[model samples]
Target: MQIIVRAYEQSCAGVLVDEVTVEADVSKTGQQSTFSVALNTPDEDGDGYVAILGNGKGGTDCNDNKNQRGALMSPGNLEVCDTIDNNCNQQIDEGLDKKWYLDEDGDGVPRGPDFISRCSKPEGNYMEYPDGQQFDCRDTGADAAKMFPGNSEVCDGIDNDCNAVVDDGFPTLGETCNAECGGVRVCAADGLSVVCSQEPGRYYHPDRDGDGQGASGSLPTLKCGTEPADPGTVSNDDDCDDADPATCEGLAEVCDAIDNNCDGVVDNATPACGGTLKNVASHYVNLGGDDWKTVSVAANGSVWVAGHDGKLALRRPGAQKFESFSHYNSAPQAPTDGSPVLNNNNCGDHDWNVSWVNANGVVFLGGQTGWIGIHTGAANFTCVPGQMPTSQDAITGMIGFETGGVTTIYVGDTSGRLTRWRPSAPFAEQFTVVNNSDFAYYGLHALSPDFVLAVGNSVTGSVQKFVSYDIDSQNPVTPPTEHVANPNNISGNVRSVWMGSATSACAVGDNAAVWRWDGGTGWSKVVGPTGVTGRFSGVVMRNDTQTQLIGQCYIVGGDGTSRAKVHRLTPYGWAKPLDIQSATANVALNDLAITPTGEIWIAGEDGRVFHYPEP
Candidate 1:
């Protein structure tokens, strides 16, 4: 229920001096009510308002609940800016004479209205209408030497300009700094500034043999300066001996039975011991046409190159130049004279497109016409008889391995079919292992004689997803197991795969997508280099656990600008771009291989070749 209370007062002259009416709802306890409007009354117990009892003067009850002697209050009675509702208008220090001190030292700035409110400036350091020039943020009291704006900055370990930057003109004590010497810089123990000193985190090992290089293998030091010592040092542990500067990393592999280049291989430069790759020269072979597709280098120094128009070139051991051959003339045509012309299935002349060379000097070259030619010698190549089923033709990838004294070659086609061929005298057809309609195999790499990895795109998904298949020797006749790999949370077709071992492999493809295969984790994508998102057609990884060059992976392909790009992966991430040419030439590196003797060779379109380590 609602309740109303009215209060009235009259003056001695018989006039209505004060009148107030309040309305409220009765509380559930029946002892109090909540007032809707309270006028000029102070709630003492806060148990809802009682009434507005005036002093018999017009609006004289500034605080109705207070004693009658305390009700005489007005705005004109306040004399200073003290924190109090002196006029009973619920406002403190309203319309009072005051002065804003020039609080330069911030010591005189009042925290609240409880300050000395004077009409004129104070006698002691305080002024009126203050600005930043008069305010000192750091000032504490009068005894403290006054620091204010417009003061000249000097390196006396104080903010002279009031800018808050202390002693920024020189390096402060205990700060990490750099010096001209190869060693790192540390704040001196006794001095006021930093000095050149050694820190365990960063130490430099200098080359004393004057070889323009530094010895590695010493505990690494994080020196900030780029200047080298008297005989400089490099930032790696590849040096076999720091005392002998001539025995540093990347040295020439001479025939002195020593493991030069610190690769743990002795006398490996010659082709007899495996082959030594050279970056000193670029040999371009012209086939009177364009389009060079792929190249493969065997362990024994046999280089086999293949491309469009059924072109094949071979560079055998001790040969200075590549010998070119044409497969167009050998492809079987329609039997015009009933003499059994090649059933090329309309695949253009001698298009022996992809080539693979095994360790036994055996090469298998295939092309679009379902033709796979076997080459035992360096010069002659023989095409296997019979054509594949029309849907299982158009070879995309081929690899071979020898097991139980027999060499078996596996071929992957565009329709996701894998076929096995036994190169026994007549190259007999073994069996078709898999024919999955959901995925298209683009590349294959043999991890061992027992396992092979097939990589390509999964067409059944909403987006083309990069996937792989593991073909084991025990189940070579059945469909291989499939595994999907996606890099950067997106899917793209994988173009190539290189298996360093059964436990380690790397695959590359569209949008610079890179994935690594591990025996423990299956397959995982690698975060590519920043700012170089482009299609990658080639990748080679070298963990080299036995040598000094461990933990290095190399990737080569085209970038967003269509330029040939080379990136090396350290433990941190992809190193900076190692490219000199721009996109003008379209230098897309299609394939790359690292030789046993520490030589890197990369080739692509326009017959372009790049040798790394730039020796």
Candidate 2:
């Protein structure tokens, strides 16, 4: 360890100004101390003044007893040593020899006889004369009496004791004064009691609250009603129910409108109708008792049911019963059993697939005879001016489009041929084959306008493919582009495809197979519940975040039946399908639609048209 000391003031001759290194060597017998010195200045020759630099002592030989006292000399006065009592008064080097003053009783004054000697041994102990005489010094106890008389002993130049002089020196013994004046003092022999002069206008707490009454004297006294009372023990008599402090005066009483406490209000004062799952109405429409095959909702919220009997019956929203229209009757008729033909001159003797264009309230039905039927909030149906392909290859799917004042219909036949029908042109000019390829049985279900997605057993193998045509192209008779293709082994005959948002779409197929499309990320398979296997019949995108796939399954019964199931697409993944109750265990869902308010409309086999409100 290295220690360094710096001095601010210069010392007299023989004072050292050097750096020294002290080292200690320890051995078995003892430790030897050695110091290496470096001197900064030299001593003058023949001047009796030697430089003490590099020397621990002030140039005094350590072996000389005469020079031992020189080691105690003050740095400034090199000639005088503070170790001897030069001006003796029985104490060695007293007075200024110590840095501090002697305050025997801590009276802020030097209890002196001003002896010129060294400080007392053991430090902090003071030497005093027997007579209690003191050296009068500035700011010391000597000056305290001369500057302030009859005042309390403050460090300021004022003696508050009033002993006919300021700070008449501190008392020799601990004493108590009757007043601030240094008179009528009571001395304690053991030097314990001490009472200084009382401050002016401030008494010794004669009475409580300092009212100066009740045993009012120099001593302190307690007054009545001054001390705080025990809690809850007050004489005010203002609180009636002291136990419950809040139920005091000025509290109002609350009524019985769900307000338990009398706070003048009710609990949950306002109520709102929270959106919750209400009742779901599922009904099956029987078409002329012909074992109702399918149900669908038209654009104008009219419920239509078609079955093997070839009768098309309709029911509007909130209607109690269904109504049937004659082949081309201008007026709607009551529910009948006859094979009601559509307004379009097409014979009504076949199972039909139906889709609605809500914008114009048009109902497009395709089955044995493909036709475009119109119902503008009226009971009558008018046919558009074009005839479909032929009865041999019935229209399996039809999509209507009216963009930029050009109305056209895209029809997909069972032979996987997509045809465009423009009503205003001649028969030969109106029907044009868009895509007539080897894609077999492609039209079980179609998506929309320009996109005709088909899934069935192809000549090559069981394949799922989508053909998209640009309707605005000048050559509208050209083949569509095949954008998606799934190997038959992986995707076994996709039966239903539902597109939502432009990005989220789902295709379901046989064996509980489901595939999801997320725009740029093509398609990925989705896992289904274990042991549940069947093909999906209808798929509808309810919203951007939810999709519903309906199909038949053998999960519940050993035998296969048309079972309706709904699945919701969440952030994590697609949820398991929840079964929707159907009138019959084997009711096959054919089509699904979601109203503007998110109500789910399902058209299924056996005229099962069910309406499920959004959950």
Candidate 3:
């Protein structure tokens, strides 16, 4: 209830103090307390609007006293972008504001992420934001034509539209370009500024055999994705065989004498005795008359041939004729030094049964009566004093290597003696006989300085023996053990042994008895080709640092009269004997050597030296 007082006639207590008092009871009312008062007035700002809110009187202005503020800046005014709630909607320029983006290039497509939502666009380097999030990938430039969406991209080092790829839209963008190496055009490494340049390429290794398995730990061939039509290649490099399809990764491993599992070990499941036999074609050079006992390949591509009656010949690589030297008997020595006369002087007249060539191409010819002849270049031989510790004996087999300028030689004599001879030792101690018995070492090879493999005959028992000596090693010395199968069952001497590595070797001997060293003390028989029986005096394998080799193993021997036989080990047993030339019919191939240059050198009777290169 409201009360009004008119002070026209009877006034209240002091005329200027017009006041009233009101009261109400609230003992048990539902509400705790409720009281409010509003002074209703009209035209407070003189705009003809009341100041009371919901007093049943007309009031529309939130700020009734609009005179203190702007005259027309009220609920009845228009809203503008001045950063203030001018129209009193509890918002500053709500419907009148716009979001501006950094469009420095003025390309219409602005930067997507960075923007300013305000009443107006920024002062500089900005524009009204586009419909969607548009990125000015390169926002610094002012090329509206080229730096906008749907524009042709050039090699101007910028991403006009943020297509995620910095270098796209080029017609030949991924063409293979050859610079320092072959590579295709990919995104720049930084993935920032676009350019004609690209990062490095993926690598693909070679698959020369078209087996889809490349050489293990292989080298990259042509750059990836840019290979030729027939450019056989493999992604994972894992192959130890060349043409054998049964070898490589994911292939079944068997006892095929190859690393079928590509684990770098030759058939670890079982000891292999044969391999993929190689077919070879041989060419021979006849030195004539004296029987050539040994042939060696020198490091400088020269071939040294030593033989009976103290004969030695040097055939430079690719030379058709031999420069022969003589000692005991008068062998033809054509002087290349223009000495006007041939060299007919006696240089140690006896049979030179073995020869070894050092790294410097110096050939040491071990001869009968404990003699050794050293030949350097010319048609002259420097005879060393007798090297035997006892009576005169012919040096049967010899192998040597040099270390720290000191040459260490191992000599095998016909009298079943094996000695280590150093050129620097005293005469009495020069030939330190390592083994002296009735066990003749026909061939001795050193897999390392500490590992020596010897194949020979046990003269006392007349049986075959394969011995390995781990000299001065953690393992004790292994004495020679005779392998006596039967009176005629591979019981002949193991004449020659060639080590493929410290763990693998091949040996052959009389009676066509072929054997494979089990990388240990045991020897397994590689039964000879059926219906063919003869002697295998020499054996050689392609040198490989790894135990799993992919090349060939050759075993040679013959009858003393006709038909020199050359056999190769096969995955089954033995390949048929290589067809021998008619000229080499009477020449029984005694020994063969494969030089580091991949040349096969074979020597035999009547001063014959053959160079056999397999196809």
Candidate of highest TM-score = 1
Q: RMSD to native for every prediction?
A: 28.3, 30.7, 20.4
> Model 1, range 1-615, lDDT digits (tens) per residue?
444443333324333443455445454555773345443434342322223344643333344445542323442345346545446566666776465544445544322222356655677655454333334545556522434555655445466556678645566544443433334444445424556564333355554444444455555545544434322555445565443422456787654223556676655554543433222132323322434566666788776666666555555655655544434554322333222222232223455546777785566776775766655553334444345543336777777777777777777776777776666635234555554546676777775545667777765652333434455555655556656554333556777777776677777777887777775435678877767678887766653322433344667775464255566653334533445333423556666666565455565565454443332
Please tell me which model should have the higher TM-score, number 1 or number 2.
Answer: 1
Residues 256-328 of candidate 3 have per-residue lDDT tens digits of 3445666766546542332221222212224356677788887777877777766666666655445555554
The best-first sequence of candidates by TM-score reads 1, 3, 2
Candidate 2, 272-331: lDDT as tens digits: 211111212222244323333334454456665544434455555656445543242233
The C-alpha local distance difference test score for the whole of candidate 2 amounts to: 0.44
- Considering summed lDDT, which 10 consecutive residues are worst modelled in model 2? 550-559
Better of 1 and 3 by lDDT: 3
lDDT score, residue 511, model 2? 65
TM-scores, all models, native as reference: 0.50, 0.45, 0.49
Per lDDT, the best of the predicted structures is 3
- Cα error of candidate 2 at position 373, Å: 5.6
Clashes of each: 14, 28, 3
Q: How many backbone clashes does candidate 3 have?
A: 3
Error of 1 at 180 (Å): 20
